[model samples]
Target: MDQQNGVQIEDLLKLKFVSDPQLSPDGKRLVYVVKEINEDKKYQSNLYMMDVATKKVARWTSGKSMDINPRWSPDGSELLFLSNRTEKMQVWTISASGGEPEIVTDMDHGVSNPSWHPEGHSILYQFTNKKDEENGPIIVDQLRYKADGKPSLTSQSYEQVAQITLDTKEIKVLLEGDADYVYSSYTNDGSGIVYVKFEEDEPESYIQSKVYVYEFDQKPKAISEIKGTLSHPVCSPDGRYIAYVGHDQKYSHATYNELFVYDRESDSTQCLTGKLDIQIGDVMISDLHSIDMSPSLTWSNNSEQLYFLASEFGNTELYAIDLFGNVDKMVEGDRHIYQYAMDDDAKDVYLAISTPAHPGDLVRHDINSLMEEPLTYHNEKLLCNITLSIPEPVQYPSQDGTVIHGWMLKPNDFKAGEKYPMILYIHGGPHMMYGNTFFHEFQCLTAKGYAVLYLNPRGSHGYGQTFVNGCRGDYGGGDYHDLMSGVDHAIESFNWIDSEELYVTGGSYGGFMTNWIVGNTNRFKAAVTQRSICNWQSFYGVSDIGYFFTKGEIGVHMEEDPEKLWYHSPIRFVKHIETPLLIIHGEKDYRCPIEQAEQLYIALKQQKKPTRLVRFPDADHNLSRNGDPAMRMARLEQISGWFDHYRLIPKTSRVANI
Candidate 1:
């Protein structure tokens, strides 16, 4: 009943300082991007340079436009980065010491994710062609703004990789993507480049384009003969070898990325991690803010070791694994440490770390002494006054007997045996895992006296590939049971949960599950589904990967078998729903499209089900995470209110926020 128990949602969503940490070649200086969220909730991302030795910080690039992706030249004299300061993104360069940046690329399409060549004469970057502003002859009919109440578009082109000469600033097409291609890293010897391509077969299905090679003299070649998605390719310091992550297409949705290496001379490949049975889920795949779009999979100057971040023992930690296949843990617990970079000498590693209570910040870890040093500090004043709920890792058995891992955040001011309202929060990606990192929604729910439970159900990543892919064709079957069992286990295992006051909420696939949960059962008193897919048939034509992903995940396509699609859709079971539901959607969400929301809302309304559809204008599929801040706050507020309204709390006890 104290004032400290009631936390502001805005305060909970404060921008922390972290991400895009890059170490200079000599291990003396580090450059990173610090993101600032203003009063209007719009963001301004700027570049900051720090002297690792002196521990002094200075803002290198500052403006309204997004300034990020700082890459150090091989010799470490100059920095190459991508910026949108001129309205369109382009390659730019600045002195490592400090000075104005010079534009290095003049192209029609915006340039992004720039990687400096080892020799410093050229740079590699990704650029997507301008979208077809006018309606065009159909190649693909996209889901359009139907979710936001607009017609879908007929066609458009994707962004791809290109090589730009620093001397002339003339860009030569390296890989023109009919699909979206993300550049990872340049070879150590600068002979060619390695990049990940995303082939958009349907709006719902996304296949990581396999690794392709672009020799300096020859056209780009598809290096992947194995036929799956390849990403985060970084070469060893010797240039004789290359390391990358490969995901087999057969188990695309369910599998984790297996690390592999390619010998340049022998043209042969070897699996570094032996056939990984589990998917490498929760390994923050890319760092767009860094000059090198590929994450810091640093090739320890000796080329014998590779240092990268991976989730182990339920937390994302710094890990060093040798090319010969040995893994060692470096750090753990404080926060999710991602976007790391190491100097060639490999004595120290620079990273961006953030937690629920702390915004992100750039920090350095000395490999030899096992000491961590803080660099630039942001949001220190804001976080200093707040009391945060620490999340505890918990495991519960699923219906089919699989044990699922999850985290529970008890309210800040807790009392034993006082049953509290509960919220079962599900994460998206179906392949993504909800670990120990801090989350605003979880804190908000617990602050309001609701026990929060989030689990890595049947299909979540962080376990191996087989575990991640477990929910593929059995979406509503085992996955649903896993979720229900998690809920059941929470009531039985945790004395804090009130059995009579259960609620559910999720987004994307999680949202689809929310729709499914409400349709099949009414155990939860209320539900909120965000950017969800209600009917599989319509999703195929509407979402960006809809055509293929829909089929892959559900084992049915709109063309060959419409019945299978319908049966797998949540709308098919709408008639059996009894729970009050709130459907939240973004007006600009192309991934799930607004129609999915409209369909469910209309069907439920027709049945007189208590339902409300809240739409965010100009928001995309990631409304809660990367969408507009104001809109994100609004969404949390609305959903929390909906749950509070329907929650059956004890009348005799003193009601406290926490």
Candidate 2:
């Protein structure tokens, strides 16, 4: 084997990523999800068991499905998971010693977010059933609702919570078709189940979600009305409290999330974190490009301390607290840290960390020693001889005098006095921040001889709440200036960046800004917008949460302020575009629907601007993170191709003359 070819694409694809590590009930075998990429570059996830003593790993299932949410049976004899192997998403279980997997329930409708009963004999899951279908509902009349503050009408329907038992094979409908319920977890003694319910105005309304708890054989009761919103209800081990995230219904949707604890008896909740204003959302949350808070909540066995990961003062770290809401730091790193698990005895905690130079690796932290050790040796063999780009943190003042923070990755193998092409990358959520994390896309751009500049503009998280909400009601105003100034600073500060060969690309909010920038000015020679929002007027109606989120963030409701929505829309100025733009979208993306790409492509084509659209099949909004690996690489390659096609090539005649 001539190994100088570096690492094969297949090897990189086959590397397994471990997540959701849970210690067995007896605290012996640790179970976690081992995710690998298939030949198609699609991710295949399965539950695996690892013995702590020998570090021995054994496969628990061999099926053609992505199994996740692995919870060991209380006796540690069986493993429970949620999979799509049966054409519909449902719960399945297998013996921990390895055996044929058995389906637990056969609900015609799909089931998701499964939680095992504390006794491990029963399972609680959330399902979406069309309650109106039994009544034989018809679509003869359109359901009219406001979208992004514009009149939008569509079909109306809803979903609710459900439960099942493994031994009896009996099903119980504890909660049904009142609204949408998701992410249910059982109390320690399995006395009750806590879940989130969205009380919408109609099928298309955007209202904050409410937290509800259902006791065995009883009607569900709304236990807490969090100030902003609540999601992922994980109960503390003692059963006396539930730990969750709380956000302002208006500004919290896009910014950082706040962690809170609720007392079961008092019916009162307390914010656990006062130092940090935001909790890092999930690496993957929604089905589409929109971002939401999904704070990983775990509790110590004693139940006195609840643990979570949040970003405080611009750094993401692991934090813990007591039932009284007193917070303490657990683990701190320079980069983004998450996916933490406490041991059964609550003596040790394991975390997955990723820095600017490191992708991600498993690390174990001792609760008593306060020491951390590397648990897995991955990527070391692949990156031994490879020289990668290092992201240098940079900051500059925007037009409005906001001192914006950002990072610049210089081209690999660079030399002085030689100018190279550059790309300005914008992050998706207008509310999200591009922190000091290991980003594959940025690395690839630098490896191809292009300097990359990314910024935490006015609306990005990590900064204070005021800074994060700065872009509200002004999609392309100060936020646009912050981004433009970042590009300008990169060009001025780095002599290697060829100003004329600059390009720009972003998804969601970034995508919106890219389209807006190309329309307002021709600074970027080429551009690519992925899963972006083009027509704000149509976004509310087409997207899953657009109706409420748009009105809250932009201060416009479809029935109230049509003019304001139109003004902030990027599609309105597409006629003035001069840059060569590429549009990439996922077919199944419902947040920023494929129609957003269609509208931009058609508009750019109509204006005679060189434009192209690359669509991914069955992919959602987060095509980069959980999307097919090969497709993601292809996207990066295509982006490089677009910039290369428009790059300023040196004249051969000039070389001959010199």
Candidate 3:
């Protein structure tokens, strides 16, 4: 492999993160956010506007702050976005022409989910007031309390939807107390907002939202009748229908989200993506971009059809659906459209796309002519000099003959006759699929002469609902076999891979699988488990979503069957592990918790097994995706160094440092 001329871990600085592309109401211009690390190696995001016809680009907003969630004004004269220039993130308004910004919300804590009225007379946003108290004894009484990034919020907090008039700057609380609301441009003719709310005090409530429209003139009316998890509800231009993405919990947490439309005229609701068998969101894992890209269901200008993105096979593509549920894939391509903005007539769509070879760039797709033009090649200069590896899609049969889909990335300087070390990379979400997208870590590893194999086993999205739910009660059974089969198929198809130097690594659920793989087999020379779970019984009581996720995936409660939980625990089979394992975890991670990694490290150390635990301080479950820039580079280097050290020596030999 060409180690010197390829992408390096520090290349993270050279990469520019382009996201949240928003088309002006007139469709003559587009505004987007470009995020990059500064002199201090800290992230700073700003807004930039581009002229559609002339391809002219100019900076719209600038600062050390992170400005995000850009939205166009109804009249297209101004832009509204969230910024963290102050002590906290708040809504800020800037003129269409680039200049300084004027603060909109003057809240002390912070605000989020900002939207404009149809007339642009006011702004709607969500604000939560902190209830500070004197130093006292901490009391616990809730089941659903902790979150991933911000560990525990033992104190009760409720987000309220509020509106502020631009002219007088007067604030009014519309929907308060336990209601989570998001506004649309003209929801209920600018007199109200569309929101999703779930009362924590409700019967057996565990975070499922109900959609409603809260009109200032009228009472809040329930738009969704089904008991399910819902998000991003938007109103049609004519205000005749409300569209949202959700699932009725038919398959618990493993259910595929379907696009549901609610007709205001007929008072009827229907699911549009139920038959598509594709997940209605971008699940492709990437370390380049922030990965929060969507209006999962973007309505067309005419309101006759809705454009949406879904994961299928090994890529995410765009599709349009009409009222009759006639879904048509707008076009076909191997690229991932993480963000897009359609024109007023829905004739031209601006896409922020990422491919196997490209980090991110902008492209304009003309719907009428069925032609696409590359709008911006922001990363071309940096990427051109680097030897980027492209992912080759491959499918293999599982133990039950079920075909598994994945991608194999060869080393940048791959040669047909030479043998290369192979690495199996697993994804975090048991429900997330590895797709046709650019993964920085994979490129870095491949540059070091390792072939990377990533696959979507059973319990992964992109596959059907049955396949996504296949590992509900069988974590180490079929999904385990599917991954092993993928590795076998990769080596079988490409015999040049040195199977004796194979390695495995993953985060979260992928980490659990890596641990399970070491215990179940001694094939891999080394394994790296990150932010993983070891004991299901302890995980059920420790993790943030443990109370439900444990039973939902394990198909049994701790009280119902403790033995079943232990049987699936990776620690139970630690005595059988032969491969040296490296455990990485975040100290403040509430999703999986550091205790999970601590348990594995302690057990392995007690047995004098070759293992090391690296803990990241002040980091949570999201450390890998959006962690501190310096820590992210260290994490990559640590994993690569461990694997390279183990593979460099011969069998039955150890590194002198170890």
Candidate 4:
């Protein structure tokens, strides 16, 4: 038998990530976004079309910038998308048969969430108003003034909903205020637009958004009366109901978004999946591509049923709910359905799916037959040459007897009786699940002769709401124990694991956990924390959503509970750290803010605790996943080399070296 080499960091650049599959009005053709790393070391996403029956694919757009948000016009004669071909991102239109795209909207700020009217003569887009620069000094009067990867509030603008007539190119602002509006879709009669609006005047507006119907030349009316955060407002084709994804703030930021339907005729709202317990909407975490916001709720043509993707037990599957509140699983498997598009008939579904074996591909799913047929193989050739590791699912009880779900990826070229160093990889969204999905980082580690262990702790989604919210008020307390216990379980279950050669790494929330683990224990020999939050006190002011996020996640206000914030912060316990640490941060990371990493690095350096800080230029919090290709590979190389340097070599290998 011949040995296949493991996947290398360079191989990651070659993998193609497909997303935003949109079935045409005729339901025979599909257009989607294929993102790949270009020669320039940056990601370039272009539109691609696929024939449903022939399984043939062709490139539809070519350019230096991204051509995404491919939404087909109602007549299917043209495709509407958001692109940055000009100086700024704007809405553009290209023929359905593939031609040069024409700029449609010339708004000062970039446009997003483009939707076409049912008549196909006009388009609705969302954009923020340009900031008033005439008034020299910028004012910071709002609690939620900044966002990660966006301009600060003082220089920022309010998101407004606008419509443009196709023939005349006349534009009209339908909704404008000190609020951010996300365009969903036009009403059945095309008399109004259904959107989620976040008004700055509301208390805790950052966490609260209402679904509203904005009529032309008329005031907007709220459709969602629930006291919770709401988004993804989708209208049924018949105009009888509005489907949305949200949950009451019973558990604050820990609440899962459940599917709900608003009866337009009855003027009442009903929770369809309140008892389902699973988190509704896409929860798949990937390092291969960036997923933009799209409509998650799709209604059947008859308006009798609604279909949505639900994150359950670690994988995303398609689920359907009827108007009567009967829930049925439409598609269930170990693969992640990141995005999907329903045909005009609503009988077939085109899905962008990723599994442990492949990065992503397009598939045609028959709702009635409950079968899926492969539609495109974008990475078939690249994957054939790569040796990928399959993860083995494991469940173990934490220190507090809470069951933790995790997976262990053995080295690609596993040898019996041979010990392999293990790496514990934590996910960013502490609320996100590490499920049965393709994780390039874990695969790369295994390819490099390292076992990778990842788990969904109490704070992670996929479990019931209670389990997901368990870690809200206790960031590093129970969640920390769950991770450590998972590591212990992995070591005990895998006899070939070299327990002493264990390493740890994570980003965002995971990064915070990595910092917390090092401060509380010295089990990990080396650690790499990326875009981590070290000081909650400073994070509340510096981060884009820090003010509200801190209160929701840590369950404390910076003004009222300064001591608690300091106590839960990893920097407070920095003196106890002994692991050789590597801090990786993005210069433009407004989420955690680069200062988070700086504070930890300086503290570790002051104590001479063997630390190094690597700051990526022009990169944000998503640097690991969607940053420059060169930087992504560089990060992986650094992480692998750091682990290799600190890993304990076996006696026989040590003797051979000597």
Candidate 5:
């Protein structure tokens, strides 16, 4: 808790990210991945284990490699994980007791989702059946041709599922063909494997995806009765029920995912968390963690109570749901538990948690007694000398009189006599929550003497379904006013804040709003839009998620309502913008393609508006979060530098300028 120096962009490389806490079967050992940016400006993670009894810690995998996705054998005798110690990421195995590791798979495209079989003899994993692009033209007829971070070419590959035996090293392809198998797991007896298959032959592949339970020598049968997208399907230990996280296509991608259990005995799928009104996953937006929208579901050993993580009003906590439609909040706190794993009987659980003041660390919690204990201090030393800002939870009435929840952070060196400049940060998801998590960007801004404000607007998760769907067809309507109200409330309530020195910035959905705000009003001094969209008409074809996302958000397809799309587009209002705007985007961002930035930049220049576009080469939509270390820091520098260039503070005592 050092207040001498605030958190700077250089600290981004020094922070350690704790994730995917996996408990050993015997409940005596803990294994998880600790990722950090090295001096080389690249991410490196390795598996680390800790003894639950003595609280002792040791490295399971070492060296400069991205070793992750660790899973213990059924008996806890051996462990398998994916590692890039070699050229391409492949499966590697090591004994849980500790020993030298050995490679298992050598696929060209690499393998992922490594899990042990029921008998603990083999491993099941996923790989792409990629066709050689050099051999011929990469022709494709699928609508889902390109994706963010993927090669910019028509996909000539299909997903395949396979298993490898440890003793014989024999590999068998269990599932393959035209469809993309996204997620997979083995049943209790290892008799069948439940996997989510996205059939790419149709136009509505994202919606028509079904969860199938494929048994060896038997055809894969659709177990999910609902016609919606699902992932991370886990079969019960008794093989009686299968639990997964997803939602029907009622709201498409914007739908709040609910936990559903498919009963094999009755052949019926029941929604377990329908009455809870919470998204069944960690939907909080954090730059410190990976981009994992897909939530995980873990069933109890008895198969009666299923444990999962959910977001409610900006707090992601652990909950347990039983068969009788009863849900109990097991671990409630104002913190984000992004990843957790339970012991054999689902009693002793380990959680990776974070808050505003702390980066993140692992904690062990007992399910029955609700007792908790800290297990790791991975970021303690790195953060010991860094002064971090603690967010004050705030709420205000929106334009519709509905209450909007958010957090406000004062500058690191705040004074009562001074007028502090403020910046409003809008989260991208329009559906993701700016929750009680450690955001490196916000802290960095505070370090440079700027108050930070971020709110989970209408389309954000953690709120109820209605609020999340509030912005679906009404983009820039209620969502826009909600943010403006928050800003107005902050300025009026706080006497220390200077309303004239205000600034705004956001990414993706927030980016679009930044564009919208500058176009609509001249209140803010400047604005920064990252990985944003300006024209919906063009975004529909270029963005990877454009087709369905546009239809889902705007409630119309490209041809269905061109005028309506233009009406919601920010580029259409470029002529009204007066604020100096900085457009930051990734060149390889398929989520919000570079063309989106291109259109807005050209339009602003044509109007002779003050604007500049900064594009990071080879970076994707996650440039601000999980991009290369140096690039991430540079992006932060650009954002802070832009705001400081228009510094309304009168060139006072500066903290550290870039």
Candidate 6:
């Protein structure tokens, strides 16, 4: 077979991103979102349906805007989805057979997370209270007054749960207050609804939320009393139990969310996966999916077992846990199950799977036989002639002797005795794992004649809780050594790598590490940092979750221990940076905030260091993954060009080889 061309940045437009697979009540059909780039270079997600028996696929929506969060009606006669077809996101219902979608809600604020009433007469959705006037001076009195990619809060606007009747289209506020309410699910008996809300009107209150059951015509009752952030409440089929995913915040945000069940009769909660030592829920990262929906716990019809997705060893697999605390891995592999929807019978599952070879495709898995059948070929034609770099799993001992897991991709069109530049790629989240899933950026680097090295450092979640929390309060300490050692091991093990022509780059936490690496050493010829935090003091106030994130990750509050915060910040050591650096940030990135990038870029320029800053307008923290297609491509090209410009050349010899 002839070697085809490698993947280019422009090819992103041709690839189809799939997500949010939901099964019909009868389990005969599957509804999912197929996100593709439009002529305007913006993403447009439309609803697609698949026949479970015949494997036939068809588009259910033809909207020019995003049509997502598709939920099946109780009778499976209509599909309720959130669409912005009218220029504002709202609940829209379409016949299951495919027809014109009817706008159900006309609320001023956009709606999300739509759930149909078991009776199929009304819909429960979430939307923030919009101010009466549109144009006015902004005034913020709360600590968390602004969120990334959202309008600045001039007045307090809390996310409230509401219901809209299909017949009259009359909207009624089911729950309202200063606190934000997120709709989870209705009780099995349909007597009340379950949701997660934070009622304390304080800055610190944003870090904690409680699961509540709001009974009709009654006050809400708290089900779980464990002191930690809780979410994804799911009532059992018999209404005797409630299952949710949460942690005790023992390690703060570094703590893995464990699956827990609340016994309504006993009035107690138990951690079902206490011995699993894995993070529950979807932790897989992919650029193919515009929105990675949270994992929903599915209950067996008998109500004896619960099924959910968990991250272990860099892979997200489906697992089942019984009421007796016995856990079983239903699906385990090197691939990533980004999102899955279980049938009502709980015997089959529909998954959005991504492997090292392909971006993503829909598939059906049998719970008993574990057999998988592919359902969609959205990216088949595009990938037919495109060569992808397959990653080889590599493991090495860190500086502290702890084993670290990683993957390395060799440059495309490799030849014997040929040397190529190497790039070390670090993942963000610090808690997120760099796993077996396909990474377009890493492949792009290899396509440009550069070997790529990516790994799950100490703070990554695939390992146990201890390993995931090992980097806390020790940023740039053990974790830094782990990354550096991985690079050293890669160069020593790969004889074709040009050790002298090394480059480093990462985003978010990885961006912070990139800054720290360049500031601490000059070994790499070039470095690129994206949406990185440079100062903890400012980050604590400006970032959406910084107040708690900094305290939890750094193990100290800014006011309590300013010295420690500054000690770990990379900006303090900027005077020592010697590598040619490029900074990339999204203008609307409130998680790390664009100021984080601006501060670093300005400081480096003041010292006359080789640096450039590229900002993407109308983009948030997820620019590289879910931002505008044009901006994402520009980001890839910028990073590639910056490294190429500063790449070192191998020494030449006059003698010719025979």
Q: Compare the candidates by lDDT and give the number of the best one.
A: 5
Q: What are the lDDT scores of the predictions, listed in order?
A: 0.73, 0.73, 0.84, 0.84, 0.86, 0.85
Off by over 4 Å in 5: 1-3, 135-137, 152-154, 648-658
lDDT of 5 by residue, 1-658 (tens): 4345688888887899888888877788889999988778789999999988899999888888999999888888888999998878899999887889999999998888878899998899999898776765667677888888777453677778999998999999998887688788888899879999886656867456789898787887898877777778999888999888888879866788878889988989888777888888888889898757656677787889888888889888988889988988888899988888887767777889999888899998887898999889999887777777899888999989978989999999998889989999999988888899899899999989999999988888888888888899888989999999999999987889998788999999999999998888877888999999899999999888889899999999999999999999998888788788999999899999999998899888888877899999999998888888889988999999999998844422321221
Models 1 onward score TM values of 0.89, 0.88, 0.96, 0.95, 0.97, 0.96
Better of 3 and 6 by lDDT: 6
Comparing 1 and 3 by lDDT, which wins?
3
- Please, what's the RMSD in Å of model 3? 2.4
Question: Each model's number of backbone clashes?
Answer: 33, 9, 0, 0, 1, 0
Model 6's alpha-carbon lDDT is: 0.85
Candidate 2 C-alpha error for residue 620, in Å = 3.6
- TM-score-superior candidate, 3 or 6: 3
RMSD of each: 4.6, 4.7, 2.4, 3.1, 3.2, 3.4
Write one digit per residue (lDDT tens) for candidate 1, span 136-170: 55564543223322234424556677787877767
1 or 3, greater by TM-score: 3
Candidate ordering by lDDT (highest first): 5, 6, 3, 4, 1, 2
| Model 6 root-mean-square deviation | 3.4
